[model samples]
Target: MNIAPRYLGRGSWLARRDPRVLIVGLALFVFSVIQVWDLRILVGLALVAAVYYRSARIPFHSVRLQWAYIVFFVSFIVLANTILTGGDLRDVKSQALHVYFRMPLLNTPLSAESTSYAMAQYLRFLSMAAVGFPIAFAVAPGDIGPAFARLGVPDKFAYALDLTFRFIPSLAADMRATIDAQRIRGYEWEKKGRGPIGKLTRTVPLLVPVTVNAIVGAEDTIDAMDLRAFGTGRRSWLRELAMDRTDRLVLAGFGLLLLAVTAASLTGLTRLWVPPFLLPA
Candidate 1:
């Protein structure tokens, strides 16, 4: 089942740039987001990511599934943090009634501080995904190994990373094929009859076939690579990834941005900031 459409297109400037540059810039961007525990700073980074996504021509719909995953994850984080981090409930009494319900059933306390903390963490994850998804879609598989190699990553590890990106779509397709094949035989795993345990029991059969097939495919791939003398010595990728003028500009910009953000964080200017709207006078 090919669940995702290709978000990368030929016309986008991001698609034309070097993957190594994207990887390095994205690392710095994530580092900036991590240094400051502030929603405003994270939102600023998200806005920057939005502009990059637009310039790359990656439509939101293309990555809607990824967004769904992020939403689910963020929900979990919000719930977990709200419950686990204890604070006085009186701090949030002035907010609307819905804000009161943000707490869980674990006899957990809620306060403006806790709410801000949870939100800051949630936005941190969201901002990371916002930047990450674009890079994942924009970079080509063939360039992945070379990109990592240029980063001083070991050749074997770089090749492994390249294969991982190349095979993810194929693995998804294989899973879909297996499920369809099973369904055609009057076997319906999603028919909604089973409880959790029963559902797990029903799913095991599906996993067995998929696992076996994947193992076989992996063995074949390994054999092919061995025959080609892969990883035996100095390895060259099929395509050479060179840092061009555009790549240099992007890298330099990211370096400056990283330095400025780090300086602000170290000076405590962007630490523990909660928007005024979230605070009660």
Candidate 2:
């Protein structure tokens, strides 16, 4: 099970850009999205995110599982918001809301404002995911630490970030190998024994070996690092990242976007915009 997001070998425009540029650009985009609740503005940002994602040329198949996870997470958040505070009309200027329907058991009224808020939340999260998933696919693994280092992160911390990125995939590969090994021994992982306890009991066989192996791997890595005198002195990265004219331009663009978003948000131009049709006359 290759569950880890592998870098697509395809040379898309985003993939060609410096890793630092992508990192800063994504940060700025996410911050901008966070500053606004206006559905219209969110829609525009979502379109921008869509274009940014499409530029990577990542195939649907490559990130299908990721998309599934994102959809599940966003749906859960939206549903929860609808149920918990669906009746709150605080944001409605007239303090009057048009109730669409009441939730079955909770009797919570799902009002127009709540519905609009849910849509805005949906677009907000989806837009973030759109820009985020591409980084795992587009940036080369080796460049992550160097990019962080070039962006003023301490040497050890930068390498730790790089290791963290690589570790998740390593752990996934280990889990896959452990599952296959257990399967050869006639372990039926899918067998739900009785209830929640049974489900957890079944996971023991898979988790124990993976956990032990992970601990041992960590120990080995620590020993190797110690032998090499890592963190004892200044570190020199094998790959030195340099920003070109295009990278600088891209970074400047994202900076400008952040400034514009901040200005809009501070000026109260990015408030929640309930559709005129949904307003009570």
Clashing pairs in 2: none
What residue runs in model 2 are displaced by over 4 Å at the alpha carbon?
279-281
TM-score of each: 0.84, 0.91
Error of 1 at 188 (Å): 1.8
lDDT of 1 by residue, 1-281 (tens): 35533646456888888888778888988888888776777778778877766667777666677789889989997876666654433224434322433435665645556677777887788777766765677876677788998899999999998888778888888888888898888878877866888988888768999888888889989999999998788998778878888889988987887898899988877666657776566
TM-score of 1: 0.84
Model 2 per-residue lDDT at 255: 85
Distance from true position, residue 70, model 2, in Å? Answer: 1.4
Candidate 1 deviation (Cα RMSD): 4.0
Best by TM-score: 2
CA-RMSD of model 2 = 2.2
